[model samples]
Target chain A: MSQLKTKHLLGIKNLDREDIELIFQTAANFKEVINRPIKKVPSLRDVTVANVFFENSTRTKLSFELAEKRLSADVINFSASGSSVKKGETLLDTVNNILAMKVDMVVMRHSSPGAPHFLAKHIDANIINAGDGTHEHPTQALLDSFSIQETCGQVEGKKVVIVGDILHSRVALSNIFALQTLGAEVMVCGPATLLPKHIRELGVKVETDIKKALEWCDVANILRIQLERQQMKYFPSLREYSNYFGVNKQLLDSLKKEITIMHPGPINRGVEITSDVADSDHSIILQQVENGVAIRMAVLYLLAGVT
Target chain B: MQKRLLFDSPLLKVTISRLCQQLIEVHGDFSQSVIIGMQPRGIYLAERIKEELESLVAKDIHLGYLDTTFHRDDFRRRDEPITPSQTKIPFLIENKNVILVDDVLFTGRTVRAALDAMNTFGRPAKVELLVLIDRLYSRHIPVEANYVGRKVNTIQSQKVLVELDEKQKEDHIWLITKEE
Candidate 1:
């Protein structure tokens, strides 16, 4: 239990309950480190990390970079838009070039599913999946769970309902694995077309009614409707989707108990959740962002011990 | 393996009292001074020392716990994974005399890491080291302690164990050696 069970954090599916707990424990320490007057440590001073993003990202990319820098590790960022990735260069070729520069780890976000998994099989360095298509965003899910544990004292036996475009979200998939592993009850509530056909096989309760879902859960994690990923309209319109599934302040106020609200951002404000609910005291959206850095720091630090 | 008692309970008590007397003489009233205990093992010794010092001076003293796991030199080079403890410094160390406390000072690496970790709080007016047991001739670094309870000559592969009981009567320091 001193080190991670796996060398790389490919996804939540690859991690067990103990691994998640270890990350949370380690992240707790890093949380203190980040809050200090001098919010930096030299644990990874000699190690170099390369953030290779094949897809566009804002928060995840920035969070990973900030986490790497806070650990005092050397960081090199690469996005597909400006890099040689646009000129017909392959994923392995780009990563191999970065590895050639003595990178010890790679934090990657790719548009294709299992890209990090593929790179892990070929590369010698550690791989952390930032986000891979609709596959899994391991760190995001870890941070979400960590935030839940921080707010609720623990994730065990808590009911968490994820409401949004579940079919196209890497966040929902990873969250289901992570929350379930930590002994939380999970439910996915969205339009029937937005939910995968076999999502019930994953052991989460499916509820299409947002009201019923909110009433049954202790926490409601609202997700954005990703228009970029949608090839065709899964729902009739954004207004229709929000009317049905969006978690508003009025909806939360009507609940028997005040359930914690969460959203993994680039939030389409007023779409998945209204401005009032997003800024409400019940929401932990900002805490989730802050915890992301610590969680990533813990992941990098723990994985660094393996090699 | 063999265990040899270095300091029994009575001797340990006398040593702690003597260390407190020396600290009192130098930093009268301890107005501008603070005590920090290194994490994991050093905290118990630090707590005992702080309690004893408070009772002697009849004044409150600032004490903090610092964990240097993130500043260690052997981070990726160590055989075992390094787990971090809590660093809870409620008061500022800026322009204050800071005394770093640890039970055993071995290769001087932990102290070195502690010094580095202390800088994150604020620059101290003066920094000093206090150790209950100093393993002489074994330091990998050039750092030395300002206050030493006892110095014992030791070789590699030997271990020094400090067991401090809550009630103080069962406290013991042992030198563990491998049997040939």
Candidate 2:
């Protein structure tokens, strides 16, 4: 299985173990390429990609743009804030307009779930779902798993606990799918209100206690508490949430063994995780950022081969 | 399919030594030169040559592996997806002579891609091609190896296979022709 099975990267749920392995293997090569003096490649030189973000993003957007540029693809970024979407242009119309301009690929992030899937059915170009509301961020999960594999030697059999709001986090959802597919034991640790009702149906262990979850896992992937997505309060307050569920150096140090730490960024320094733990030696937060580029490159490169 | 032995183990060993000798004669201790092997199959030849050259010249010759999967012109055109190997060039090629090594030079496309791949790692003072098997009259691009092991005339249906093994005695080069 040298090639990816699917044409578009809509979600990790659509991928099998072989696809994930191929992406990681290819990403390993891209990782080496990005570390070189000249970090750019001519692979996607003839391909044009449009980064159509229906929502705002910082790291994912920058990472995708950097990955596209490094692959030598011509990129045009579109955000919803100032776009024709504000003028009541439909999603299909906006994408069709971009496609008419001869765009070969679209990396889209929409506020609604399955937006990329919707566009995939209508558009001829390849569609990479950057983030579709609370659905999934495939690249983030891939890079997170890649980082784990890089650090701990493998993702198989390792205990990885995702610590934070799982309901509103596309990162958590994608991470669970990717980690499980790669044969890792996954556990979601957060307050009861933040976790979705049927999260156990996804086959991951659920734990409301942060310390017990920390003690049981080899790696902890801390997620940000999305205040913007919360219309009503899930937890009492930020201070109380931090008091119960926050991961700090004291909590980590209290563990029986030193476990690897991870956080998909825009980290709440003292809210979900403290400054010391975020910047600690156990943290692979920064490496995740770097791996994001390589993972995205591997995805774009592989999908470009589909036609 | 028909297979013909182009070079046996003994011949391969002698050819490699001769190639290393020619390299030593030109590079002269390789103080300002680096050997870069094209990825996938080329690294084996590059490793063998680097080992032979170091022992012959009694100098540590810097060697690197380069993958041209990203630079290939036939990228979306090929039926099978091109998988990239690792590119491990630790040192910069600035103002240094680069000897690009490969096992087979057939369509000249891999070498062309290698040329583009090598350019990313600074500008080399001089770049030279070294191939174990040169498939004559089969180039799609203008690429000629500086050090050629054996030039064998081949048709479009013919393929050159250079097998370099850990056990040096098992090394053999074969010309395979597809029979319809």
Q: Once superposed on the true structure, which residue ranges of model 1 sit more than 4 Å away at CA?
A: none
lDDT of 2 by residue, B1-180 (tens): 899999888998899999988998999989999999998999999999999998998888899999899999988888867888888898889999999999999999999899899988899999999998888988988899999998888999888877777988898888999999
* Residues A1-307, model 2: lDDT tens digits: 2799999999999999999999999999999889988899998999999999999899999999999999999999999998899999999999999999999999999999999999999888999999999999999999999999999999999999999999999999999999999999999999999999999999999999999999999999999999999999998899999999999999888888999999999998899999999998999999999999999999999999996
**Global lDDT of each candidate:** 0.94, 0.94
Q: How many Å off is the CA of A229 in candidate 1?
A: 0.9
DockQ by candidate, in order: 0.69, 0.75
Mind giving the per-residue lDDT tens digits that candidate 1 earns over B1-180? 999899988998899999999999999999999999999889998898899999999999999999999999998887767878989999999999999999999999999999999999999999999999999999999999999999999888899988888898898899999987
Worst 10 residues of 1 chain A by lDDT: A1-10
Candidate 1 overall Cα lDDT vs. reference? 0.94
What stretches of model 2 exceed 4 Å from their correct place?
A: none
